[model samples]
Target: MKFENLIMNVGYTDTGYSGIVQVVILRMTHMSMVNYSYLVVDHINNQAVIVDPAWDMRKVEQALENTETVLSGILLTHSHLDHIHLAKPLAEKYRCPIWMSNEEIAYSGYYAPRLEGINITPWSVGQIQIEPLFTPGHTPGSMCYLIGNSLFSGDTLFAEGCGLCFDVQGAYNMFESIEHLKKRITPDTLIFPGHSYGRAPGQKFSQVLKNNIYLQFKNKNDFTAYRLRKGQNKLNFFDFQ
Candidate 1:
């Protein structure tokens, strides 16, 4: 999607200092207009990172300005334009790296000067540390991040839904990814999704498992069937419900 096509701004929220990072939701184009853009900051160091920023560059800058947090870099959950639209410009402006899954790079054909792999030990910007996991679903390069007790789930997971499964293999990987995450992280791990509509922040992961029907599917075939059933139809990114 072209930046000129987007007119909405990113949303912001203060997560307090409970080891949970603050979030900013940047609405994007079409049905994804309700998607969330995230600005996660390290409370102690005031250094921050943005996750799946959509389009509004000014809003991201203002969030960093108001919080006194320096933009460290950008993290991508997938190659979806809505998730990565602002990464290029933001990284260019800050001279920061754009962390992403290499598998997604193949799909996006994204050309950026600072694109870097997100698979490795947890990365740190000041006092905050982020562990990126390869969770392919919704897309071949879908990913998720772990920061302290909070999980910044891009299109992989949501408050009451999981990301759409476009690729069957990728969907299987997503199932495996969430299973691993569930085993490794605590139930209390706060979930900050790529889209939350207008709901409050800090939703728990355990709750999603219980409520997300897509996540409860028995296998990839079942999940695929579900996704096909929920096809976009005539909905634009703005009308996604």
Candidate 2:
């Protein structure tokens, strides 16, 4: 099915991940905490993948129960608190490996300060397949996921805005990542970000290509100047990547 066609309401309760593909977007009413996370289930194999699980572990567990799919693994886009607050607990509860980029694995503690030695690196499990793309910029280890044609862009790419680039290096890296995504991912890919601020849950990769003005900046200097003008006083190097 087309990725846009799969979009659904924010509060998709009682939804199960089955069939060829299933996505349930948990409602995150709180500010800076929108869209708890996404559970992508592949019904063909009865396996599941959890992406950026943020709030209500019970809801996630229940989604798994409803779908009759195993909690195969967790994919983290970055080490941001809201994106990964529930990761360790969920991993412990399901005994599933947590996957992320090698960079995130090494420098995740800045955001997840309480976590020590949490195994965060890329490894696949179950029927859900994930191809990791190193899209640093929102943070040094920020990453995105490619599942089928859907890109689970954790703060890296948003519908109308791009991930916040706080540092010069990060901004530069983000520019590169955006360029890479444009060239590598399919135009039909749907973007599922970590937070949408109560907006719809997904956007086509093509839309971001056409509309994300941050990506339109001719150079990193231009993008950095734009961010500075926006009044971002501090660098958030460890927040997005």
Candidate 3:
């Protein structure tokens, strides 16, 4: 579904799930660097969870009011500034726990009284069952969230591209992480990336595998070279020196 720009700068796209649990996923697009934040709402239970809460709160607030759901938790994909800058404030304002990988807390030292460090185990917020996938590439503690068939990949995996690596190690990790995802992701699984580099937000995983260049690399060395290649450093380059 196309994200229709609403009153605010944010573009909203609502997608519904089926089966024993039914919930709606609202995608907030057009954040800094084309970042996308999401709201997983259980309207029947009046509970909601925010994913990678960043940028302005107006768009997120509007989504809450429209759904009549109260924020129950915040899910972080990683510790990057664009993806996690607002976690503390949003969690405080809504009085909810901020959930992230233990690796992130250790790597970035993200501190908060309400911060909850999670493993690969799956959990639930109301009807929405959240599964954490450890896909560290962009950051040492990078993570991706799996809710039903939707993969909320922060920066690990973009629509047709992947996140830049910090070093040779990060690039290797990203390659392995994506290789793991390929085994789990099915054709129907809708990938909701953290940013839109080239393709749109919600694209089928089948299409992604076919079109994504990063996924084409089976050799870690080649992936690393290309990921850290020249001309991409101005904005995304991370200098280890």
Candidate 4:
């Protein structure tokens, strides 16, 4: 479904033990870059949870109103400025807790105080269970939300590329995280990334493995070398130095 200038990709999954869970992707753009937020709704209970609420609250608010689903909580993959700018307002408005990892809380010095929410570990909203996968790299405490067949891979892993690691250690961590994801997540799982920095906003894990160069590295040292070499040319070169 398309709304305004954003595209809403909808997916339905049956959890075998329970009823169906509906996943909706709300794609929006800010600063000439595309950002995506997700709504995972348990239709049977008329409850929903949001992932990475960015700019443009009206669009998000409209989505909630249209679905007639009460906002249960908000999930943050990481505490980046663009991702969490609207989190405070949304959380206050809905009277819901924002779920973020403790690591993210420590990493984001400025935003931490503003985030009056709950720490993300593993929790459930109705029948839709949320497991926080600690995929740190882009920032400490960076995580991916594992809900059924969907992986909300924040800035850690994009559709075609991965996040920019500012230091060698961060690069290594990012590499390890990707390796961990490969071992655990199914190839058929759908990946909803934080930024639309790829050919498409989201893709299946199988397609991502096939197309992403960073995910192909099996050796940590090799991936680290590659990341450092690549980072030298990017805007964060100063950080690497």
Strongest candidate by TM-score: 4
Question: TM-score rank, highest first?
Answer: 4, 3, 1, 2
Relative to the true structure, candidate 3 reaches a TM of 0.85
Task: Itemize residue pairs with steric clashes in candidate 4.
Answer: none
Judged by lDDT against the true structure, how good is candidate 2?
Answer: 0.69
User: How well does candidate 2 score on lDDT at residue 238?
Assistant: 26
For all predicted structures, in order, the TM-scores are: 0.80, 0.79, 0.85, 0.86
The sequence of per-residue lDDT tens digits that candidate 4 reaches over residues 74-144 is 88888877678778888788888787887877778535333543455667888778888888888978989
- The segments of candidate 1 whose C-alpha lies over 4 angstroms from its true place after superposition are 1-32, 197-199, 230-241
Model 2, which residues run further than 4 Å from truth? 1-19, 29-32, 110-124, 230-241
lDDT of each: 0.70, 0.69, 0.76, 0.76
Model 4, backbone clash pairs (residues 3+ apart or across chains), number: 0
**Residue-by-residue lDDT tens digits, candidate 2, 191-225:** 78875632355676777778767768877788778
Off by over 4 Å in 4: 1-15, 110-121, 230-241
